[model samples]
Target: MMFNKLFSFFTVFLIGSSICFAQNANRLDSLVTVLENNKLPKNEKIQLLIKIAHNHTNTDEGMHYAKQSLQMAIEINDLVLQSQAWEEIGTIEQRLGNKNNALDAIFKALHIYDSLNLKDKQAASYMQIGGHHVGEKEYDPAIIYFQKAEKIYSEIEDDLYLAFVLTNLGEAYRFEGQLENATTSLTKALELNKSLKNDVVEGYALGNLGMVYAAESKFTKAKTFLTKAIAITNRLQGAYPTCVYIAALGSVYEKEGDFLLSESKYTEAFAMAKSAGLKEQIRDFSAVLTGFYEKHSDYKKALKFQKVYQQYQDSLVNRENIQKNEQLKADYEVSKRESEISILNITNANQKRWGIALISGFVILLFLAYLLYRGNREIKKSNQVLSDQKELISKREQEKALLLQELNHRVKNNLQMVSSLLNLQSRELTGHPAREAILSGKYRVEALSLVHRKLYQEGVDTKIPLKDYIQELVLGLFEGYNAEFEPNFSIADINIGIDVAIPLALIINEMVINSLKYAYDGIENPLLKIVIMQETKEDLHLQVIDNGIGFTKNDNEKNNSFGLKLITSLIEQLEGTMERINTKGTHWEMKIKLS
Candidate 1:
């Protein structure tokens, strides 16, 4: 990674290269000479001093310059320069690991920027805050800050900074394991950087894109993207991020079953990380290369890297523990000094004074005993109340379960009666189409009745296990059709609310009936499949497919049948969408959102 890329991601909001550019002695001389020429405005001079302070943030001189700039800005009452000074101070604090203090300083800058309507500066401050949050690994808050910065950058038509913020936002999302969102944001950033001819931004974005694709196991695309990214970073001599890209490519090659290429890339990345003195990257490469060698049956190399990785990991842990121990020791000394001073405040006392103190202590002990006795009584009373409430809650739950069971039983009976009425009516019909319609209606009613039957079968769980319900429903449909081929079901054990279940069952009934009545006509070895699964926490997917004969768009337009319309209506009722795919036969997919 170039220093800019590291500043963008690893550091807490380093801003642009201009903010902390490598110190050029000639440029520093020119700025100092300009400052010495007393004709310039003080506010302008303060800005120059702030730039100097920003450049020196890694040293004590940085703090001195920032304080001097802040003092001058205050004397002139220049809010703009003051805000700039505070932000520089905040950057220094963040680098020193004083996160809370950094936040305070940055927010102060943000407030002034907001007051001055300095949209770009406000965006910069937001990005800084976001980077701080990312350093803390509070990704959600970091995303929110980045989003705020994004909005400002958008308003100002600052596409370059916007792209930078998006890249960071994508990294945050990637770390949070939101791969889809990360891909979207990073792809946008990549496009913008390319359009703007920003090679640095483009390189970083490509590296991130490669990592995202690799995580999704799109190895071909991952390899292509990472190869391009590595080429770019190599041309720019960005060894840090180049190591990252190489490591990512190594993992992709590993997964692609190219052990030789994987090892080569990993070895190269390790060498780069070692040269860069990036301890974390060194540890990571060692562990992954160890695994690669082991998988390749090279036990000696595996053991070597394994030992190297363990040594680095142990060193890191020891360093952290030592720092913690030092802090604890310092805290102990402070407390011990306070204790010694407290002891020295006491002096020798007479016997009469000691006796009075003992009497007072005895009286205080008696009072505490009375209070403890009362506290025990209160605890007993509270426990008694809790026990009674627990019994009441249990009783109420049982009663509710019984009531729901009874309701389901009644609804099932009512629906079954309706089904029987339709069956009787179908028997009296002479016309073939009329009789078929009646039977279809009867089956539709029976589908819903089956839900209630299963609802009350085992317990009063209102949410029904869809696997067993779908199995029973398909069997009932087979019996109704008197067909030899039984439909197959791949149903997950997902429980859906009754409101959604009723409409879903009706929708399935309509689609399956239409397939059996029309699609399978004159077709041998008819096949039917039903799959119900939860795609996500919010999405439930249902697919009913058949392999017999298919219908075209023109056929659907000509028919516009009641079954099709009913399916559409029921899907709408359940707040879902349906798509029909016809090839050898018809496939109906319904996507429903759960409440």
Candidate 2:
């Protein structure tokens, strides 16, 4: 159980059911003979060789056949066959404990898989690579590679392979101290394996979960899970998970202070590991046994198991050095082949030196002709694109203008309807003041409606020309009030935003109507001056002066009326200020800030 907590699991990606040819050597030999003599395509022959390679017991012999297959596949330019051969070589290297060589061979296959867009094959290769990283104690990189495999498997709907990857991923997470993630992945793997009826994988998942629980000090749950896992693995004849769970059960028992039960479990697991020929498990179980003996104060047994553990450790080191030497020889062979290729390239280059010079001169002439032709084509293409873009822009502008005209027409109609309603209501009223008020409202509505009518007639955009808008508004007001003389107009030639135009028109209507109604009631020459112009770089000014009766001393009482309040609110809304100059006549001046 301590092994699971501190060490990463070395997982094997089972691509398919393994051929039991190791126990049937005669059958394997027959296949190899058929491969050697058959008149098959180079690709098929290379595949047959790879099959024979997989059956070999000796790692070096397996690698030799794999290399032969690879060479034949390359000669035939069969990328899929080459990738298969490299994968076989990688498996053999991993079996021989040459991790770096194993990774190099696997990556070569992965490169081919990627170029061929073989998603399933790439996922399988990623799983194998991740397993090798886990064996090398690189948990972070191992988890990443395993996740890549998981994604592809899920996308391909390969649930069986996905479950296998999840089990391996859970072990990687456990070793990395991510217990929650480990539990979740392992639980999912367990459920998936159960659904697929893959008892072998299910056993491993359960055993791993048991170890994780033991690490978390959940002894009761750990014991129950390990017992079930050991029973399943033992029935299935899986020595791997059987030994792992047995040893983990021993640790749970030891943590619960049941020394006798712990010793029995460890001794049984050690025997199973020895019979399985699992050197790592053997080493782990022996170390656990040594600690178990020491915990019981049995010095003699502790010392004896300690010596056995050390021997296994030394054998592991010797095996590692042998793997390194094998890897170096492989690398040396690869380098020699590259050097031969380099020499062959140099010889070929020298033989073609004169031919290259002649070709180069012809290529230069051809390139110059191509450049001139391409330049002319590009210029024509650019001109066509410009013409098309200009036409498209013109069409869009026409559509926008039509839409604006429709909008203004609808608004003018709505305002006319409102004014008609007010006029009808005023005719029904008996009070003169009420009727007059309704007529004033009607005139104000007509003033706004005339502005919209002019805007649509001219087909302008969101800006209303101030001079045109004011002229139209004044003419409509004069017609509504039937003034004896038209109000003097002195407006500037400028454009204002649509938002400012509406409020400015309403203010003009109110001021002019007031002057017509009261300022010239009994006065002669009845001069009403309306002036609007830009006062400064940041201000626009409007003034209405009348040579008629000015505001009386009691004007404050009348200033609180609705019209005055409306004017005051509109000025505030425009963020402007107004002043009433009580000279010979009432002179109203307003300064509005330009945005």
Candidate 3:
């Protein structure tokens, strides 16, 4: 009972039976006794209350006791009692025709189910609330509630409850004029009830199925399903009373134009109502009789039954006003709670703002401090990087200067030693070839000396231009030979870096010596030419020409000439390629790539 009061209510409701008034009152009274004194255990008492609210009396006195029990259950804060109470409230509201209050109570129960994470409770409450709305003739809301409940019931493996809810949903849909949807829902409920051996749910489904067929104007289907429903009701032996079953069948017979059969059914329904003492169904019997007499075109009898039906309908509507007020009271209690929550929220928001502001200020200060520290470190690191880069540039420059100096010194000294050796060899010989070798070595020394001379004269730290150095190298070689040469026979204007000058001068010495000594060996006229130019930004082109007998095949005959070997080695070291084209004389071409 307490559980019902605490959490139940979210949907519309009722588990109705065509029970006699006396039996219904007795059942409600017994529920009150068990729930009032807490005679049963917590769960048991809650279940009892749910049963009473679902299948109890249809009287106002029954509702009053249920509400009291529900309130008491709420005070105890028991979840089961809470759910039961909300369900009872919705049911009572539905009976009283106060649909909104019924809806409100069920929603409260749904909120509780959400808190408790009880899927079954949620589903059951939805179905109950849906049923309540249906009673108020609010079929749309009723279908929504029942469908939600059916879905939840399916989730928890409660086939019986799921079928029950679906059957209710089908009824709602039927009343809303959706015969197809109604038929589908009822059929599904029928299958589920059959599986669970729930003949009551099955019978409800069958009756609803017939109602849908009737609404759709499918008389054949309507008759078949109603006949089945009648059989189910008979087997249940008045457990759900006989009046509704007889009335449903009578209505079908009238639709089929079977006056005698229809009359028989209506009489039987009236008899059952009298025996059961169910005031509502007894009143519904008058409407059934009216439909029968109208089918037979008995205007007087039809009008009488119609009047009786009208009276019954009026009383039902009048009874609902009481239900409406009771629901408003329930809603008032819920509104009170919502107001308390809103007030608490406002107070909490005000309190939280200061804490949030303090935390935000602290965070901002921490971030700013971090940024400042990082900036200072970054500045210091940038300064260090600049200092290191400058030092590296300076060191490389100094090392380059020293390297050029050492290389220049070694070249000058090595050439002089070779010159001295050549001189000694020349002195030992009596021929001109020995003197030519001596002169050639001396010319190479002169070419290297020019680089040192420029470094000293120009006062630059490391490098010297090769133009002046090459001119000096050629002049020295000519002077040694004491041979005349025109400007056209010279490459004196060639330019190169000091790095390229020494090797180029050495190569030139060999070429010039070989030509002068051999090309003019027997001839009187001799010619030589050299030219230097750049083929690309990173490449240099060199050419040498001689007007004399061309190179012999013996020149390349391997493993012999020291001059040729030295020339080839220097070409490799410079990463330059050389090719020869012979005509009247040798034409040598080279293209060198510079780093």
Candidate 4:
């Protein structure tokens, strides 16, 4: 009776597997027919190729089709299509048990998707990476990536993809022994899929939930959920999830002391996995059967199943070795092709250079002949014309200089009038908050006016003498603030263009104002020193030191004020860096790079 029952079960299983295979074959045939049209657009062809690859995911044909899609995508320079192809290739590699290669391909896809800012595609790649990590029994990283995918899917409001991520996340959590989290994630995924009417992912979530319950020793719940999961997975999904659900059901039965039913379910799942050519599942089930028989002291059956388990394990290792060898051969062929292309390019470049050289030599000879054909009178006339042009250019340059100086003088006068107006406004607003702000504006305007004043007074319009400019600016600040200390200057005899001079002057003005207003409070004697030295041909070092109280809390708060922000902007404009040291007093040092 038992033999007949087992035979009947095998027959039904084989028929169902055959039906699934036929459906896949029909799908592949239809896709290939669509792909055969040579007049199809490259983009459409790449899409079809990817679809075909997905259909053949269980075999090498999938990799072949994926690579074809990648090549076509590259030819058309379509980044999105290329990323999709790479993602398909990664899925195929993972199915083929090349975990490392799968990870590498998926990461390549993720990088491209990230660059293109495709959130959906990035989440998909993250899920793929998490699945690979789960396969390797590395649950921590698996959960991390699954959570990352979850976050993105939620942000995009993609409940369908979110359900898929949650299903995987729950499974990873179950494997890592976090049963509560596993149940929570799987339950949410189940509800999401049901709401979305996605029966496929719903089946996955149900199966994972069953596995989690089993791990928690809830035998009744585990069996109930596993049975329902098997019904849905077997009818809607395929051999993979159905086989896993069946194995979990068998384990639940064993825990409940139903030895006969447990053995039957294990044997059934193993046979189905073996018939489907799922080597990983086959090896796993065989090991389970081996342990089951040993628990019952059935040595003969235990030995038989143990040998089957070892056989498949060896087969997996040999397959990996063969894959490695094939990869090495492929790499060598690619390298050889690249070297041949490089040599051809060099030969073409040398030929082109020789052709250019011949043409240039002939042209040069013709030019010499032309020069000889000309008379001395023509040469004298050309020389006279050149001299006349030079004289005219020099006069124009002198005129431009005079005009620039006049413009600078007028700009200085205008800025002084603005400063005077600000002073007048401050007097009227005495005892008001606006008065202080107006005075600060006056000082900044004077700093800029000083730059223009130096440009108009100096012999050179573009360059300013740094030593003289700093001295006058600092002295003017002291007189404006009515400070009691005299500032010492140790400046380098350097010349700078107006671009650097204007910003530098404002920076000095702000720093001096900060020192006078904040640094010298509650001090008996105050000293301020300004130093500028040439660090290199294209670098300058500047120091502003004050012998008073160090940088206080008030100064820190002032750093966020408009004055400090303006100083920061000017420093950035000059491509310079500043460092503040509060030892002894407050020391501000800067390194400015000349552009």
What is the alpha-carbon lDDT of model 2 when measured against the actual structure?
0.77
The lDDT for every candidate, in the order shown, is 0.74, 0.77, 0.64, 0.77
lDDT of 1: 0.74
Error of 3 at 249 (Å): 1.3
**TM-score, cand. 2 vs. native:** 0.47
Task: List, residue by residue over 199-236, the lDDT tens digit for candidate 1.
Answer: 66677678888887877878788888889989887765
Q: Compared to the true structure, candidate 3 yields what TM-score? A: 0.45
Where model 2 places Cα greater than 4 Å from the true spot, the runs are 5-7, 16-105, 108-112, 318-595
Candidate 2 to native Cα RMSD, angstroms: 30.9
Question: Which model, 3 or 4, shows the larger TM-score?
Answer: 4
Model 1: what TM-score? 0.42
- Clash list (residue pairs), candidate 4: none
What's the lDDT of the predicted structure labeled candidate 3?
Answer: 0.64
Q: In candidate 1, which residue pairs clash? A: 1-240, 1-241
